[model samples]
Structure formats: C-alpha cells, structure tokens
Target chain A: MKTIKNGIFNENPTFVLMLGLCPTLAVTNTFEGAYVMGLCVLTVLLITNFIVSIIKKLIPENVKIPVYILLITTAVTALDLLLKQYVPALHETLGIYLPLIAVNCIVLGRALSVASVSSVGKSLLDAIGIGLGFTLSLSLLGLFREVLGANTITVMDGISSFTGYHAVFQVFPENSIIPMTIFQKPAGAFLTLGLFLAFFNYIKEKRGAAK
Target chain B: MSLFQLFITSMLTENIVLTKFLGICPFIGTSKKESGAIGMGISVTVVIVLSSIITYLLYNYVLVPTNTTYLKTLLFVLVIASTVQLLERIIKHHFKQLDHLLGIFLPLIATNCAVLGTTLLNVNNGYSFIEMIVFSLGSGLGFALVIYIFSTIRERMEFANIPKCFKGAPIALITASIMALVFSRFF
Candidate 1:
C-alpha cells in the first residue's frame, strides 16, 4: 500500500521524478492517444510486477534483472498483439513507439524497483498506482498538447470525432497562431518540458516561502 | 559503399549524440568537467561496442530461431546491466587509480540511453555482426566526441557570468540545440 502511494502522488514518476519523459512528450498529442498508451503501460506494469514478485527469490541475485526483463518482454509482446487486433488505428499512430516502450525507463524502472522491495500483492498494487500515475500525467500532457498544438480534440480521426468545445483548444484562429511549431516537434517537447520545469520550480518556491 | 565510408558517416554524417539525441541526461549532467567527460566517453565507447556485438550475436543465434525476438529489449538490457556490473568489479580490482577517477560515473552506464540505444539499433537495423560492431564504435565515438567538446566549452563557461534563470539544464539544453543545429547542417 505504501509502495502504491509512493508511486502515485507522493513520488510520481512523471511530474515529480521526471523519469519517463520520452514517451510522455512524444505521444501526448491527443487525449485518446494518451489514454490508450497509458492503459497499455498500466497493463504491462501490473502483470510484470505480479509475475516477477513470486519468483523473485528463486532467481539468483546476479541474474535477477535479466530475468525480470525477459518476463516484461512477454507482457509487451502480448500487449502489442492485443492492440493491433482490437484498436487497429492506435496501433498505427503508435507505430515503432510501441515497441520502443520496452526501452522506456519507467516500465523497467518499476519492474526493478518494486520487485526488489515488496510482496507479490504489494508489487501488484505499486504497479497499478504507478501505472495510473503515469496514465494521469500522460493524459494531462496530451490535453495540453491537443488543445494548444491543434484546433481540434480528435480521437481516432476517421473512425469518429469527439467534437463540440473541441475547436476552442486552438489558442488562435487558423493563421493567427504561429504554432510555435517547435512545440510540436521533438525539440519542442524538450523546450516545453524545460519551460514547464521552470514553472514548476517557481510554484514550489512560492509555496515553500509561504510556509 | 566501403566500410570506411560507413564508419566515417556514422561519426560525422550521422553522429549518435547530436543527431539521434539518445543520451541527453548524461550529456548534460557530466559535461560540467572536462576530465569526467573524457572518462565517460571512453567507458561508454567500450561498453557500447562490446554490448552491441554480444547482443547482435545473441539475436542471430538465440532469439530469432526461438521466436523470442520480442524479448530482445529485455534481454539486451539484462546483458548491458550485467556487463556494466562486471565492468565496475573489474575496474575496482584491476585499475585502482583509474577506477578512483571514474568511481561515480561507472554505474551510470546502465542508465545512459546511448548504450541501450546502440544494442537496440543493431538488432532493429539488422546490421551484420561486423556492421554492428562498427556502428557501435562509431556511435560511441561520436557520443564521446560531442561530450568531450561540450565539456571543454562548459569549462570556459564556468568563468563566464550567466543569468539566474537559465543556469543549469536550461543553458545546457540551449547549448545542445545549437550543437544539434550545427550537426544537422552536416547531414
């Protein structure tokens, strides 16, 4: 329970720790995209944590990390297949990024950290909490990206459009916004993250001063 | 093209650090001191080259036929992490002086995305084992090259007066973008 609590709000992976920014910035362009990807990680983390927990002691200490990794790949593989068959379009937008998730520092970080610490159930809860924390942060980033970057709040494009109050996401009418286009590219992701980091620090300073 | 061409291109035309943007965390944090930068470069270069070769072989011989290529990412990380573990042990035993110098930076190899990036790139790019070795070396060297250069600039930066807001990561990132822009011109 404490592990779970630490993973979510107390020691949040994204905002507080700033550990897994790669995928968080890359995929947060849309709400649904963020949700789907976050859910995928959630599923992977939970299953991997549970499986690794029971066998944690059986594996030699020297080989534990590799063994954990092998266990994770199985979960990722299964996830990749499931996404492809059911949500075909998301399967496309995600593209290589999905496989790239295996290298994501967060998933592996959780697997190693939680597995080394707690009970099977405790690990399972930790995976869930962290997974949810990751999902929440990603969804927020997606919302910010979706509203500011584009004029529309699109979900799956041609399949359907979740419209109304959507177009307001654009800060400016078609030609008015320069797009700060950098924000939309990989470099923009960094710049946005950097600026926000400054903003977060500023807020923290103010709060601490108040105390 | 010739092997020389591939090697040359990997270093310049397609530098791993500036172009790929794989290992920014260390590039920013460790580039404050020149000697640390150089040590990091050499250590990372050795790890990248060695690990990629092993991962390439493992993929071809074991994972592919077993239909477990999906497991490559997990497997590669394990290999790299354990190898790094061994590297720390060897450094402690064999090269006490150098190890003392590189003491803190040693285990960081596990965290550097460049190392993981290389092993994954070799498998994904399907470089022949030879090409894998060359690419790994070139990438590592390119990484080493950039970090060393950045640290030299930062060494001078210590003497310069900088603004309050843009002191650490911000200044480092702006420097990175500039370097990246310059590197992009080559490609």
Candidate 2:
C-alpha cells in the first residue's frame, strides 16, 4: 500500500519535480514508447538502488559522484544490451534515449537521495515508488503529446510498415485547427513541459486558495 | 549537407533556445534584467563553447581512444561539472557584481539539459570540431536572444493584469509556447 502511494503520487517524477525531460519528451510519442522507457528506467532504478544501498557504507564521500555514475552507466548499458537483444524494435525507437538513462537523474536521484538512507527492503519499495511514479509521468506526458501532436495512440510494433491509429480526442478538421508546430520539435518539448509545469502550479495554487 | 550549412543551420534553423529548446531553464529563470541576461548569456556562451571543445577533446583523445565510449556520458558530465565548479570560483574572485547575478545560475548550468543536449548533439551529429564551436556559439546566442525577449515580456507581465492561475509559470509557459510558435517563422 505504501509502495503504491509512493510511485503514483508522493514522489511523482515528471509532474512534481520535472526530472529527466530529454527522454520524456523525445521518446514519449506513443503509449508503447512510454511503457518501454518506463520499464527500462524501472529496471535501472531498482537494480541501481539495491546495489547502491548494499555498497553505501563502502563508498567514500569524495568519490560518491563517480561511483554513482559508474553504477548508472553499467546498469543502463546492460539494460541497453538486453533490450536490444529482446525487444529490438523498442531498442531502435528509443535510440539515444535508452543509453541516456545514465543521465536521467531520477535513477541516481532516487538512489542517492533515498536508497542511501533506507534499509534494502525500504530501498526496494522506494525504487518501486519512484520508478512507477516516473513511468506514470512519462506516459501521461506522452498521452498529451501523442493525442495533440499526431492524434494517435499506438501500442506495439516490430515492423517498419506497421501504422499507429488513434481517434482525435479534440476534433477539429485539419483545416480549421491551427496545429502547433513547436510541439513537434525541441521547442515544443520545452513548451509542453512548461505548460504542464504551469498546470501543476495552477492546481497547487487553486487548492491552496480554496483552503 | 556541407560544412557551412551545418554552421548556418545550427545558428539559425535550429538555434538552441529559439529552435532546439535546449537551455530554456536559464533562458527563463536567469533572465530577469536585460543586462543580467546578457552577462548570463555570455557566461553560458563561453562555458558552452569551451565545454564543447573540452568534451570533444576528451571524447576523441581519451574516451574513444581508450574504447571508453561507454563512459562518454559520465566523462562528459564530470568534465562539465568540474569545469563549471572551477569557473564559478574564477568568476567570484574576478568579477563582483557579475558574480552575484550569475552566481546562482552558474552551478545550475551543470544540470541544464542544454549543456548536456549540446554535448549529446555534437557527438550524435558527428560534428567536426569547428562545427561544434559554431553550434555552441549559435546555441548560446539563440539562448541569449530568446532570454532577452522572454525577460522583456516577463517584466511587462509583472504589471499586466494576469489571471490568478496564470500568474507565474503558467502564463510564462503559455507565452513561451506562443513565442516558440513565433520563432518557428525562421525555419
């Protein structure tokens, strides 16, 4: 129960703190993409946390950063290889982002910030909490992006010719609707993240005002 | 496809802030005053260009040569982090007012996606050393240009009758979306 609460809400990665936006925006064009990323990050987070926890006492303070980097790199590389071997399609679509999990911060942030303090059991729970939180956030953001950008939702694919089809949530004939071009590019990545940040703040403010 | 096109394209077509969306955190967060924005821009510009060269050297000279491309991400991050730390000290001792304004943001540059984004972009794009510097400078200038504009809007926004919900980041983001849309005209 506590584990569930941790991932879904309290330590929510995307909405709460805005960690790891590079891959969040880049890979999250579809639900399946988000799921793959989420799973990958989840695996990295869980493994890194447990290992970091076990080795916490041995690591010297000065070299902590390097230690963390090596740990994340190893895990991400291993994950990269495994994913490529098993889920070659997701591996291709994810591309740079999959390797970029090394810098995602959520993995290291959770590992350093939480795993160091808690017991191994607690760290495992925290990993799930944060891992799931990050996953959920990535997908939700992807949901917004996929719906608005392409008006599509796709699940899984192993072939190049396969198509993704999703009904338009907000129907406006293509001619009438002014499709935002920035949303499709890096600028759009910033624009969307900023808007979502604003949305989170607005909700926080509104709830605060009511109280 | 040619070298000059890469230079021109990075500078104008995919200008980092206005186009590539790298470095928007500092673009929006540090750009409260025009003068300060300029200082921050120059500081960031210098750091980015240097970091690019350094990371490139390290990648080519050390990591790649050693078959440590696996460590490229970590090594790149370490180089930038330590470099920024050193630069922060130099700035604090050398410039007084500049330090106070840009000081808060100097360290933040370490984590800025733009910093990592450029490093990642350079390697990913397989840019030559000259091309990397050009891209870095263009990215910096684009960042400076947009921050200057965004700051002007924010200063004006302070006086405008903004809605309660849209008061801070909300309105700012909405404005940026439009501004991004506006910048898209160049492409």
Candidate 3:
C-alpha cells in the first residue's frame, strides 16, 4: 500500500520523477492516444518488472544493463506485434511511439531500480503502483490537451468500429470559441506540462510549510 | 532526397528534440551548462553516427538475410550500449583531455533515445548508407545546436526573475515551449 501510494503520489513518474517525458508529451495530443499509450506502458511495466525480478540474481553484474535492455526490447516487441494484430487502428495512431516504448526510461528505470533489487512480489507491487501512476498522469495530461485544444473529449472513437459503442463527449458546440490551437501542437504539450509541474510544486511547498 | 536537403531537414526542420521529442531527457539534464551541453552534443553525434552505420550494416547483412529483423530493437540497443562503452575506452586511451570532459555523460549516452531512434528511423526510411550517414550526422549536429542555444538561454535565465513555483525544470520547459513555437516556423 505504501509502495503504491509512493508511486502514484509521492514519486509520480510524470510530475515528480519526470522519467518518461517523450511519450508523455508526444502522445497526449488526443485522449485515446494518451489512454492507450498509458495502458501499454502499464502492461509493459508490469511484465518487465516481474521478469526482471525473477531473473535478477542470474543476470551477471557486469552485463545487467544490456540484459535488462534485451528483456525490455523483447517485451515491447511482443506488445507491439500483439497491438498491431488485434488493434490495428490504435496501432496505426501510435506509430513509432509504440515501438519507442522499448526505450522509455520509465520501464528501464524500474527494471534497474526496484525490480533488480527487490523480491518478486515487492517488484510486482511496485510495477502496479508505478503503472497506475503513469496512467493517471498521462490520462490527465491527455484530457487537458484534448479538451482545451480540440474542445472535445475522445474516449473510444477508433475502437468503436469493432466494438459498436462510440464514446466521444463534445464539451461545446463547434466553432463557438476560437480554439487555442497551440494546445494541440508541440508547444502546447510543453506549456501544459510546465504548468502542471509548477502547480504540483506549489502544492508540495504548501504542504511542507503547513507540516 | 538530396544530401543537402536531407541534412537541413533533419537538423532544423525535423529536429530530434524540439519536433520529434526523441531525446528530451539529456536535452534538459545536460543543458544547464553550456560546456557540458557541447560535450554531450559532440558525444551524441559521434555515437549516433557510429551506431547508425553499424546498425545499418547489421540490419542489411545479418538481420535481413537471416529473417530475424524482428530483433532490430534488441540488436540495435546492444550495438549502441557496446558502442558507447568502446567509445569511452578509446577516448580515455587516445584523448585524455576529451575523456575527462565527457566522463559521466559517456555512459549516459547509452540511454539517449536519439542514438537508437536515428538508427531505427534510418532503416524505416530505407535510406542508403551515405544518406543514413548524412541524416544521422545532421540530426546529431542539430541536437547539439539546439542544446547549445538552450544552455545559453538558461544561463541568461539565471539572472531573470522567475516565480518560486516555476523555478527550475518548469521554467526550462516553458522556455522550451517558446523555443518549440519558434522552431515550428521552419515548417
């Protein structure tokens, strides 16, 4: 429980640790994209953490980093293939960012920091905690970007073709206000992230002062 | 695409950091000091170019013929990790001064996505060997250029008044947002 809380709040990957900024900024342009990316990372994190923990002792100290990289790359490749075969549309939307998961520092960082040093059960817990934290952060960032930038919330448009249940909520009428188009651009990603970081820091300082 | 055109396109138009966001970790991490940023940039360039060439050859010769192209990501990462290690040793042995300059950052280059990203992009785009070289070199130079400029800006930012909440990383990111807006003009 403490481990989970630590990951989700104390050491939030996006706000606090700031480990995987690339995917956080790049894919948050749309809610669906961000959601899927977050889930994918969560899944990969869980699997890699479990595997790395189990085999941590066997991996030679000198070659552990490459070994971890190989493990992560393999897991990401498997996930990529599965996504391509099952979720072709979402897969297309993800594009290279999906494969880039193999290099995402969050996954490797956990593999090195927690998984490699801890017991298998503890590592699994850490993975779940961090995964959920990452998902929350990515989804939050995505929600803000999509809502403000496009004036709509995208939940499940691409998946609707196969599932037959559309899920998009329009916040306002189209053309009502001049959309701040920058929120959808690369610049918007940085700005949104910066503001969020600042807000988190302010809250932390306030809590510290009160304590 | 022509060599010069590809060079310019990768360097400024499709910047690895500002546009693609491949290597932001080191971009912000090492950009606090201009001297450190230059060292990182040059090291990244050398690593990217060397890794790209090696990965390209391995892909065309070993992976393609053996029908194991699926292992590109794993193999490319291994190549990069080893390349960084080898480069470190060679620099330490040959250029003692340069080795001292890039001591800690040498190993960190292994994780910088730009190295692997460039190699993967080169293969995905199906560039020839020479074109791959130019693209990788251009991307490295571009990364270095942007980091150098950003470091200078950050140095000046030290004197400027910033809010307490937006002191360190947040301000840098906001600055990057503006820089990204400016870079978008190249498009």
* Top of the candidates by DockQ: 3
Task: Please identify model 3 stretches exceeding 4 Å from their true place.
Answer: A161-164, A176-178
Docking class of 1: acceptable
**Index of the highest-lDDT prediction:** 3
lDDT per residue (tens digit) for residues A1-211 in model 3: 9999998998899999999898998899999899889889999999999999999989889988788888888999999888877778888878777778888899999999999999999999999899999999999999999999999899997667667778988887778563678999888999999999999999988999999
List, residue by residue over A109-202, the lDDT tens digit for candidate 1. Answer: 8878776678988888888889988888778767666666665555555223322222223345677665544444444444555565556657
lDDT of 2 by residue, B2-120 (tens): 76776666665666665554665566567667777777777777678878889988888888778877666667777777888988999899988878777876876766667767887
Give the better candidate number (2 or 3) by TM-score.
Answer: 3
Query: Could you say which candidate leads in TM-score?
Result: 3
lDDT of 2 by residue, A22-54 (tens): 577677666678777888888999999999999
Give the distance in Å from residue A22's predicted Cα in candidate 3 to where it truly belongs: 0.9
Provide the TM-score for each candidate, comma-separated: 0.77, 0.81, 0.96
| TM (chain A), candidate 2 | 0.85
In angstroms, give how far residue B33 of model 3 lies from its true place. 0.6
B1-187 per-residue lDDT for model 1 (tens digits): 5678778777766777655556666787789999999989989998898788778888999999999886776677778888888888998999999787776777888756778877877787778877777888888999899999999988887787866455566566666655665665432
Local accuracy of candidate 3 as per-residue lDDT tens digits, B1-187: 7999999999987888888888999988989999999999999999999999999999999999999988888888889989999999999899999987887788998978888888989998999989999999999999999999999999999999998999999999999999998887533
Distance from true location, Cα of A66 in model 1, Å: 4.2
Which of candidates 1 and 2 reaches a greater TM-score? Answer: 2
Worst 10 residues of 3 chain A by lDDT: A172-181
